[model samples]
Target: MTRPELKTDPKYDDYDYPTTAPEVQSGHPGHTTPEQDAQVFQLRTQLEQAGYKERLDTLCMLRFLRARKFNVDLAKQMFIDCEKWRKEFGVDDLVRNFDYKEKPQVFEYYTQYYHKTDKDGRPVYIEQLGKIDLAAMYKITTGERMLQNLVVEYEKLADPRLPACSRKSGQLLETCCTIMDLKGVGITKVSSVYGYVKQASAISQNYYPERLGKFYLINAPWGFSSVFGVVKGFLDPVTVQKIHVLGSNYQTELDKQVPKENLPKIFGGTCDCKGGCALSDEGPWQDPEWKKPPKWEQPSKTSQPTTTTTAPAPQAASNAGTQAEIKGAQQAPMGS
Candidate 1:
C-alpha cells in the first residue's frame, strides 16, 4: 500500500505552525522507514484477515512494526499480545467509565500531568519522579487504580491530544514531549520505586510504542548518570537516543526546545497559571479559539477551486497578502 498523504489547507497558509512531511522521516528516532512501511502493510493485511484490522490503524500498525524493527512475525505477535492484554485489562471500559476521584490528592504526592505543548506541537507531559511517595500514594489509590489512570491518560493522548495537535499543525503528530524531573532523587528513592517504574516503562514500550518524541531528565542528582547507565541497558538504543539527561543546570537547554511562557515557573519559566502549570493544560490544542476543525471537515487546498485572482502565491507573498487583506477588512471607514 502506498503511504497516505496529509491534506493541507490554503486557509492555514498564514498560520505559523511546524509542518511535518506525510511519510515518516527515516533514521529519525520515532519515525519508520520504507522497509518498515512495507512490513506494516503486510502486517495490516494479515491482521485484517485475522479479523483484528479494526483494532489497528496505519499509525498503530507502524508502531508495532517499528517496535520489532519491521520483523513482520514478531511485530504481529507483539500486537496480538497487546490486544490480549487490553481485553484482560478492560481498557475500553476503563477509558469510558473509570474515574479517579483521588486524582488531586494523588497529584500532591506524585506529579504526573499533561501540561501543554512543546515547540513541535507535541503534548508536553511532566512527571516528577522524586516527588513520588508511593506509600502515601497507595494510601489514597491502589496500584491497579494508578495503572488504570495511566492507561486512560494514554488513551487521551492518542485521541484528543495528538489529533488536536495534528489539526493545529496540519501534520501527523504521533508522539509526546516528556520531562521526567528527578530533582532530589537518590539511590534509595530509585530502588524504592524501581518495580513500579519498570512496569510503567514496559507498558509504554510494549503497548504504546513510538509515543515518546523527546524525553528530558532534568535535575540529575549525584551518581544519577551511573544509575542511568545501568538502567539504559534494558532500553532500546532508539529510546535512549531520544532521552537527554541533564543536571540542575537544565534551564538553558530546556529553553531552547520549549517556550518560557509555555513552561511552568517551577521548572524555571515565566508562566504560573491560575490553578497550576501542571494542571492548566494550556496550549493551542486546548484553546477553543485556536483549535482546528476536525480532519473530515477541514477543506483541503487541492480540493478547492483556484481562480487567477485567488491562486496561491509564494509562501511569503501569500502571507503578506493575507495580512494586508485582513488589515484592510478590519479598518474602519474614513469620515467624509
Candidate 2:
C-alpha cells in the first residue's frame, strides 16, 4: 500500500492531539503495570496516604496567620511541606492561622488583604475581603538585599485605619459578595472591605446595583469617623431613618438581580434590606441601636485598644529572649 501522502498545508499534523496516557483501561492480568506517566497521580496519593494530619492542620494555621485561605488540598500539602521544612531544619509553629476555629468562616475564606503602599508616607498593614501572596511574604524567611528592601517598602503601604484582619464597612461587602455574582464579575482585590463599599456601590449602581437595590445613603455623614470610632449613644437616629426609608423596598429589586442560589436571607441587622432592621422591632436607627440589633450576637466593636502597638516592638525587644546572647557577642574580642 502506498504510504499516506504528507499534506503540504500541514493541517493534519497541526490538528494532531497528543496523549501521554492510554485512553483505555483493562482489568486483565499482566498489563505490565501501565507506564511511568500512568503512575503520575501516585505521588499525590502517597503524599495523601502519608497523612500528616497534625502537620497538615499546622500548615493551615501558617497560611491563616499569614493571611492565607484554607481548602482541603492546601491543608494536606501544607502538612507535607511543613514536615519537609522541619526535616530540613526550619522548625517551629508549623501552624498559627490568626484565628481559633476548626474551619474558617466563608467570609474569612473570601476576603481581601492589603499590600498597598505605593501611595503613602507611613507604614501600615491592611486586610479586608481578599487574598494574600505567600510567595512574596516579606516578614522574614529569605535573606537578600531585595527582600530586605521589601520590608521597608511594605511599611509605607500600611493603613492606619485598617486592621490586620480588616473589618467591613458594614454589610456592604456581604452585599457585593452576593450581588456581583449575578452580574458575573468576581471581585479579586485582596484589599476589598467595607472601606470600598462606596466605590463598589457606585460601580454597582451604574453597572449592577439596579440588580441589587438602591444604595441607602450616598456617601453620607462626611467622614469614616462618623461611622466608626464613635459611641452608639451619640448616633443620630434620624440620619439612619432616612437611609432606611430611601431603600426600604429593596426585596423586589433583589429578586430580579440575584440568582436563586445567591439569594440573601433576611438579615435582621446585616440584612440586604436598606429599609432598616428586618426584625419588626426596629425600623431604622429609630430602634435605638444598630449596635446590638436583634438576631445578632456580639455588639459592634467600634473602637480598638488604645494601648495596642501600631508597629512591631522596637528591635531591642523583638529579640527579647535572645538579648543576652546578642549582647555578649557584641562584647566579644575581635580575635578571641
Candidate 3:
C-alpha cells in the first residue's frame, strides 16, 4: 500500500499563490554533511544569487505544486527524483542495543510472548513487542524526517533546545497561530496585527528559573473598530497604541513622584539577541550614561500622586476695583 500524500489538488484555481522558487541555505555547526548536503546547500545559495524571494520549503512547496496541477504518480516520481525519500536514521546509533525505551515486553522477559490459536486451533506465538527496558535518553522524540536542505522564510526564532526539552520560537509562533484560531480570529484575518502577539508569546516562553514567564500582549487584538473616516486616519488605531501611550504616560508620572536616583536601572549587553528591540531595554531609552536605580530602591508606583498642591495666597488689591478681581481669582475652582 502507498503512504499518505502531503498535498491535495483542487478542482478549480480558486487561490493561486504566486509561484516562488524556494531559497535553500546551508546547515550550521552540527548537521552539515560533507556529501550531497554540500551540493544541495550550494544550489540553494545560487538560487538566492539569481534574485528570487518566494518563501517556499523545497519539499513542502513541491508537494503543494504537484497538488492539483499534476498527477499523484507524477508527484511521487518527482519526489523520488529529488531524493526526498526518508526513513528512521540508524537505530543502533542510539546507544547500541537500545531497543528504544518503548518495547518493554521484549526486554523484561526474553522468552515471554502473547499468543492465540489460529483458525486450525494450532498454538500461535506473537512476538512480545512491549516491556523493552531502555535507559533514559536525552533526545526528545521528533516525528518528521530530517531534510537535507531548508531555507528560512522569515526571521526564525533562535532556540537551541530540542522540542522535548523546551519550546523554541517557531514552535511558539505556531502555537499562537492555533490560539488566534481558537479566539475565532483566523490567521488570514489578523495576519499583520498578530505578529507582535507572536513575538510576545515567543519571548514569554523562554526558559527561566521562574515557570516560563506568562505571555501577556498588552492591548491585544481583543476588540474591534468600526471606523467612518479615510484609511490611515486616526480612530485610536489598535489597542496596542493606546496601551503604549498609557504605559509611557504612567511611567513618566511615576518617575516624577520618585527621586531621580530611584529609577529602575537599565540593562543592555551584546548578549541581547533581539535585534536592538526594547523588550529587554531596562534603563531609560534616553540615556544609558545616567546612573541606574540602586538595589535598595523599589520601582516607582504607576499610580498618580495623592498629595494636593498648595494654592497661591490671595493678594490684597490696592484699590476696591482690583479687590473684586482678586476675590474672583481666589474663588475660581480647580477644574475651571
Candidate 4:
C-alpha cells in the first residue's frame, strides 16, 4: 500500500518566481496533511456559519491554527475573537484611511520601521528602543495613534510587502526578521515603557499570531536576564525560541542572519540610505516592478479597468487576499 500523497498548489509552478519548496513542504498551504487540510475546511465552515464574512482564506486559517497548535476549536475561537476585535477596532477604516502624519516626529523619539529583507527573503524590521523617550514621543503623538500606525503598517505588510517580497525572491514570505536594539536601555527606561509595551505585546500575540520569523535582541545590558524572565511570560515557547539575546558584540551574529549590504550602518552594516533607514521604508515593496495598490485599494468590479503595471499573483492558498500577522513594532523584550 502507498502512503498518502502530500498536497501542493499547482499555481505555484507557473508563478513568475518560484515558491520555495521548503515553505510548501513545511505543513503550510501547499503541503498540508489530509488531517490538517480537513481542519482548515472545518474551520472555514465554522467561521462562515458564525457569520465571518472576510479573511476566510486557507493561509489565514492556517496561521490561526498553528498559533493554537492545530486545535480546531481553539483556532475557531481565535478567529472569531480576532474578527470581533477587527470590527471594534475599526480596522477596515483604519487600513484604508489612517495615515501617520506625525511619523517623522514620532520616529525622532522612538524608531520602528521596516528597512529591507534578510537572508531568507523575509522583511527585516528594525526597532531602536534604547533611545526611546516615551514622554517626548507622547507629546508629539499619543500612544493611541502609535498603535493605529502599527496596525496600518501590519496591513501593508500582509498585502504589498510580503507579496512583493515573495514575487521578487521566488518564494512565499509571510513573517519578518526583527532587530531590537537595546544599547542604552536601562531598568528605569523599561519601567517607563512597560504600559505601552504590554498593550502592544497583547495586540501582536493575540490579534496577529505567528508573524515572527526571527527576533534578535542586541546590545543587551547588564541585568537583562532577570528582565527577560518576566518578559517570557508574555511570549509563548515558540516565540521565545525564535528570540536571540545578544550582548554588545552582536554585529557578527547579526551579519550572519542579515547580509551586511542590506543591513543598516548603525547595526555595523554598510547600507546607508540617502535620507535614513527609518524613514526610507525601502524594500522590494517599493520597487516599481513589484509594488502595487494594496488589496483594500483595488478597484471594485463595477469600476472600469485602468492600465497599470501589475504584480505577479500571490500564490498562497488565499482567496480574499487576506493575510497579516505581526509581532512587529512591539519589540517587547527584557529592555526597552
Query: Which candidate achieves the best TM-score against the true structure?
Result: 4
Of the candidates numbered 2 and 4, which has the greater lDDT value? 4
Query: Per-residue lDDT for 1-336 in model 2, tens only?
Result: 432221212211221111111112221111113332123223234343554222121112222222112233443343344344333431122111112121123223322111111111111111121232223322322223222222221221111111111121121110111111111112343233323233332222211111111112111123422543343233233212212211234445434332332222431112343432211111112222222222112232222123432322212111122222212111110000
Worst 10 residues of 4 by lDDT: 317-326
Q: What is the lDDT of residue 104 in candidate 2?
A: 26
TM-score of 2: 0.17
The candidate with the higher TM-score, 1 or 3, is: 1
Which has the better lDDT: candidate 1, or candidate 2?
A: 1
Ten contiguous residues minimizing lDDT sum, candidate 2: 327-336
RMSD of each: 16.3, 25.0, 32.6, 8.7
Best by lDDT: 4
What is candidate 1's lDDT per residue for 129-222, written digit by digit as tens? 6777888988898887877777777776765567677677767677777787888777787677666655565556556656767778799888
lDDT for each residue of candidate 4 in 133-241, tens digit (9 for 90 to 100): 9999888998888888777777777777887888878767778888988888877987898777767766666667667788888988887767776776666666677
Q: How many residue pairs clash in each candidate?
A: 0, 15, 11, 0
Q: Model 4 reaches what TM-score against the true structure?
A: 0.82
Candidate 3, residue 48: lDDT: 36
lDDT of 3 by residue, 196-250 (tens): 2233222221110011111111112323222112222422232112112111123
Q: In candidate 3, residue 2 scores what lDDT?
A: 38
Indicate the residue-level lDDT of 62 in model 3.
31
True-vs-predicted CA distance for residue 12, candidate 1, Å: 27
lDDT of 1: 0.63
Ranking of candidates on TM-score, top first: 4, 1, 2, 3
